[model samples]
Target: MLNSEFIATVEGDKVPRKYFDGRGMYIYVQPSGAKYWRLKYRYEGLEKTYAMGVYPRVSLEIAREKTEEAKQLLIQGIDPNEYKKNQGFEIVAREWFENKKDGWKSRHAQVVIDSLEKDVFPYLGARNLSAIRPPELLTIIRRIEKRGASRVAEKVLQRIRAIFRYGIQTGRAKNNPASELTGVIKTQKVQHRKALPIEELPAFIQDVKNYEGMTSTRNAILLMLLTFVRTDELRSATWDEINLEEKVWHIQGDRTKMERPHIVPLSHQAISLLKELPSYPSKGYLFEGRKAGHSISDKTMIHALYRMGYKNKATIHGFRGVASTVLNESRLYSVDVIERQLAHIDGNATRRAYNHAQYLPERETMMQWWADYLDEAQGINQVGIVGRLKGLFSR
Candidate 1:
C-alpha cells in the first residue's frame, strides 16, 4: 500500500520506476521525475495498463477509487478501457451535436446544446450510454415534466433519443432507452398565435399606418404585413439581401428556419416602403437596433404592437398566420405558389432544392395583388377595387 507521504517523497532514478499501491495500481515515475497514476490489470488473458491521472492531481484516494471502479467493470466482464473510450452519455451526445449542428442555425444550435447541458448532462453525463435503462431515462424526463415544463421535457426526450441512436450507430450503446419512453409525458396543447380576422384586416392596416410609434417600428410592422416573413428574418435583414434592381429579397440559407435559401419577390409597394426607409449604411441591417452592430431586439416590434393597443388581439408572428389564411382562402393562386412565397419547406427534398424561384412570375403577380389589396383596405378607395378584393376573398 502507498501513502500520500510516500508518493510525495518518491524520487525517480536514471530508469523509470513503478511504486506499487497494491491491487494492480501503482505510480509510474519517469527518469525526469514526472509521475503518473496507472492501473495494471488483466482482462480474460491479456494484461493491460490504464492511465489514471498524474500524481498530485489524482491523489491516492481518488486513484484507489478509480481502480475499484475498473475492478467492478472487470467483474461484469466489461473492459474498463473500452468503456472509457465509448460509453459516456455526455461524450456521445456532444459528438452527435457537433456532427449535426453545422446544418442548423446558430441560435438553434445553441438551444440544442443548452438543453443537453442544462437538462440532461448533470444527471446522466458520466453514466455508460448502454447502461442507462428506459426507467432510468424516464425518471430524468419525468423530473423535467414535474417542473411544469412539459414542452421542454418532450424536446429533451427527443434529443436523448437522437443521442442514443447515434450511440448505437457508433457502437457506443446497444439500446436506445429513450425510444421506449416516448409519449410517456403529456403533450401540451398547441396554441396558435392570435391573428386578426380577415374582415379585420382593413382596420388593422389602418391602425398600423396611423401608429405613432417610432418610424422604424411602424415601417417594420408594415413590411411584416407586406412580406409576411418571420420576425427574426425581418429584423435581421441586411441591406445586401435586398436587390432593388432584381426586385427580389434573397434570404440566405443560414438566415432562414428551413436552412434553405429563399427568394421573396418584392411587390411595388414593398419596394416603395424600402425606398422610404431612413438612410442606413449599405452593409448594415435594414432595421438596426440601438446597439452598434446588432439588429433590433426580438421584442421591439411586439412591444410596439402592445403600445398600439393590439395586445392579445395581434402578435408579430400572427401576421404570417393572417397572410397564410387570407391567401389560401382567396384561392387566387396555387397552393404551391402560396407556400413557396411564404418560404414553407416542401416535403419533397428534390422539389424544395430546385424550387426556390419556382413560379417566380406568378409569385410576382400574387405579391403585387396582395399589396394592391392592402392599399384598398387602407382607405385608398379606388372604384371597384374594394369590390374586386371583397369578391375575390368572399369564398
Candidate 2:
C-alpha cells in the first residue's frame, strides 16, 4: 500500500523503491526522496502502462485522475495499450505506401520515393501521423514547387493525401490535411512534344539508307517506320506477335490504349525486311537491342537520325507525319479512314465500328504504294518516281 504521507517522508539517494497503489497503479520512491507516479492497467485484454509524472510534478490526486480516465476507456472495450502502439508514423507510412504502389506507374513511383526522401522524411518522419496538418503539407509541397517542379509538387501533394488518408483509416490521424489544397497551389499543364513536318521527307529517308551508322541504329529506325506505332508499343513488341507469312502484326491491348488487339496489316516490303533481320526467330523483341531482353532505347532512334545528317529537320518519328501527309495530300483515303489507320481517337464510335481494322483494303493499298514510293524515292530502282507512283492510283 502507498500513501501521500509515506511518499512525502520517503528518503532516497540513487535507487528507487516501488509501492503499489489501488487499481494497478504505483508510486516509485526515489533515493532522493522524490515520488514518481506510474499507472499499470489492462484494456481490451492486453497490458498497458502510462507514465503519470515525475516526482513532485504530478501530485498523488492528479495521478489518480489519469488512472481513472484510463480505466473508463477499459470499460468501453478499447485498448489503451494498442492505442499507444498505433500512434507511430513509421508503421503507418510503410503500410500506406505498400498498399499504393500497384496503382502507380514505374516513373510515378520513382517521383513519390524521391519527394518523400527530400521533403516529407526530413521534417515529418518522426512526427506522429495524427499530428500532421494541411499547412504542414503545404509547406512541403511549396518547397518542391519552389524548385520549379510544379508537376512533381502536385504529385507530392497527391502522395501526402494518400498518406493522410491511410493515417485516418488506421485511426492514427483525425483528418486528411491534403484535402482542399487546390486553391493553395497553382497547377500547370503538361505538354507533349510532337515530331516535325513531312514535306521534306524524301531526302531524309534517302539519307537513312545511305547514312554511315551501326546496324542496330539503322534497323530500329526502319522498323519504327514500318510499324508506325507508339515507341513503347513497338519497342516492347515480341517476335511472337509478328507473322511474316500472314503479313500481320498483332498488338495486344495490354500494350495498347484501346485495350483491344490491334492487328496491323504488314506490307509485302515489310515482310521482306523482317525476313532479313538477324535474329527475328532467336529473340523475344522483334527489334531486340543489346540490352538483354529490353527493347531498343529511344536514344538509338534519336542518334540514328543525327548520324543521317537530319540534326533538327527530320526524326524517326517524322515518318508517321510523312506517311500521313502524303496519304492525305494525294487524297487516296478519306479523313476518317486515314485517322482510323493512324490509330487516332475516332470522333464517331459508330463509324469506327464499320472499320474495326481501319479500312484494311484501302490502307493495304496505301501502305504498299507508300513502300514502293519509298523504294523509288531512295533511287533503289532505276525507274523514275512518276513511273512507280502510277501503280499507286486507286483502281
Highest TM-score scorer: 1
Which 10-residue span in candidate 1 carries the lowest summed lDDT? 380-389
lDDT agreement with native, every candidate = 0.85, 0.69
RMSD of 1: 10.4
Give the per-residue lDDT digits (tens) of candidate 1, residues 282-308: 677787677776678889999988887
For candidate 1, the lDDT comes to 0.85
Q: Estimate each model's TM-score.
A: 0.58, 0.53
Error of 1 at 154 (Å): 5.3
Per-structure clash totals for the candidates:
0, 3
Error of 2 at 127 (Å): 12
Q: Output the TM-score of candidate 1.
A: 0.58
lDDT of 2: 0.69
Stretches > 4 Å off in candidate 2: 1-202, 257-261, 347-357, 380-395
